[model samples]
Target: MEFFADIADVAQVKEMQEWLPLDGVTTNPTIVARAKKELFTLIEELLAACEGIVQVQTLAYSTEEIVAEAKRLVAVEPSRIIPKIPCTQAGLGAVMRLSKEGLRTTVTGLITVPQGLFAARAGATYVAPYINWVDSMEWSGTEVVAELLAAFEAYGLDTKVIAASVKTARQFRELASLGTNAVTMPPETYKTILEHPLTDKALRNFADNWNGVFQEYKLDSKLKG
Candidate 1:
């Protein structure tokens, strides 16, 4: 399964490359604006920075606008960017049309299990269900994650359940255990994984020991000549 972080800043994009475990990225108007970069310009930069998937949302609020945005996103570079649509009927219609055009579409918002199912029915490539947003509203947020994951597998939808708005490592673990295909976090949470004490302890222990460690060089006396 692939993992993604929902970061907007190009600086964060470079930071993620340093940590290097995260697999992809997702951007919306809010996030794209955070980086102080134009939508198309950000997409171009992301295709260069990230060696993984880039899920880019269309700014259009309606089906017709979304279709136009999808065309625009595809025109830049089809391989890297997946067109993201909201979970409205018009968005679903746009998803269906773009999907038929052989463009990847992701459905995202405050998604319920049924929404994810509907998105899959529309042939969406990714279904983004909000985790932190759901919990903050006092819902059994984790259950929805589990439900969608199972529903996709059971119904044989090609859609990938990407846990969205993940706030912390625990939530990341929760979605992971549910067999979610990916989780998109903010840059802070992405950095948090590296600051974990356990990971630090493991490296500390390894560096402190050198019991009979040996090294050999295959290079010749004159620069391996």
Candidate 2:
């Protein structure tokens, strides 16, 4: 499974690079704004930072407009970019065109399994279901993930499922358990995964027990070797 860093700032992107062993990034217009950078500039910066795919979303309201913009983004580095579109009819059409043209597409804003099914039919490279949002409505994200995965596989859809809007560590684990191929985690939540009780206790115990003899040697080893 792929762990996608969902962040807005270039600083956070750089931090993720140095810390999180993630697979890719997931971005929307809001995330771009949060980064406090221009859309294309942020995309370029993020693309440069990560070795994996960088998803740049389309904020266009119509298929034609989005497709035009998507074409431009894809022209920059088609293989490295995943064009994210909404899970609407117009978005679906744009995604289908992009998919057929061999541009990777991620259909986001998914609320229901049927919407994901539509995205799958459009040959979306990834389907992002809003799992946390579903949970807020007292719905099951797991059911949606499982259904989409099965439907995509059984019907020969080329689309992959990416569970989105993941909040807590439990939600993250649930998404993974549900067989999602990828998930987008907010920067804070991603950091939280490293702060579990076991990790904290282990670090604390090591720090309390250490006599500091290995610090210099470890630093030298890291720097020299």
Candidate 3:
């Protein structure tokens, strides 16, 4: 499964890249506005820093306007930007057009199986289901993911499901168990994925043992590579 950083800050993006095998980055209007800089410029910097596809959202309400923003993003980095269109009527329309023109698109903001089906029909390369967002509404986010996965296989759609708005490691593990194609989460959440008291205690024991044995031992200069 592919993992993406759901972050907007460039420094955090760089740190995530340095630590993990990041596949991409995802951002929305709220995220973009956090930088307080030129939108596309910041996005381009992020794409270049990570050297991976960055899903950038469109704030437009119409299909034409959405496509226009997508076009501008592609012009910035044709091969590394995936226009993030919502799974709305106009958004799907724009996705259909953009996909037909050979541009990769990520249809985000999905909450239902029908929305996922429509996104696949519109030829989106990826479908993002907001896991926590749906669960916040007291809906089964895992159910949404499960239904979409089954529908995609039943219909033989090539579109991938990107589980978005992931809040915790438990949610991430559950989504992975449900077979989500990809997941986008905050860097902090990803860092906690492998954190456990037992693991830390074991590492400390190993380090203490090693230090006890190698207190005065050192590699000779001739042994250095």
Name the top lDDT candidate: 3
Could you tell me which residue pairs clash in candidate 2?
none
Tens digits of per-residue lDDT for model 1 on 133-196? 8888888677898998788889888888888878777887777677788778777776786488
Residue-level lDDT of model 2, residues 1-225, one tens digit each, is 888888757677778778768788889888877678778887888788787888888888899998998898877777788888888888998987887887888989898989999888888889899988888899987788889888988998868888888887787777777778988887788888657888789887775555343433343432222
Q: Where does candidate 3 stray beyond 4 Å?
A: 209-225
After superposing candidate 2 on the true structure, give the runs of residues whose Cα lies further than 4 Å from its correct spot: 206-225
Ranking by TM-score: 3, 2, 1
Poorest 10 consecutive residues by lDDT, candidate 3: 216-225
* lDDT on C-alpha atoms for all candidate structures: 0.80, 0.82, 0.88
Kindly report which residue pairs in candidate 1 clash with one another.
none
Supply the global lDDT for candidate 1: 0.80
- Candidate 2, position 223, lDDT: 26
Model 2, TM vs. native: 0.88
| TM-scores for every predicted model | 0.85, 0.88, 0.91
Q: Please tell me which predicted candidate would have the highest TM-score against the true structure.
A: 3
Instruction: Name the runs in model 1 displaced over 4 angstroms.
Output: 198-225
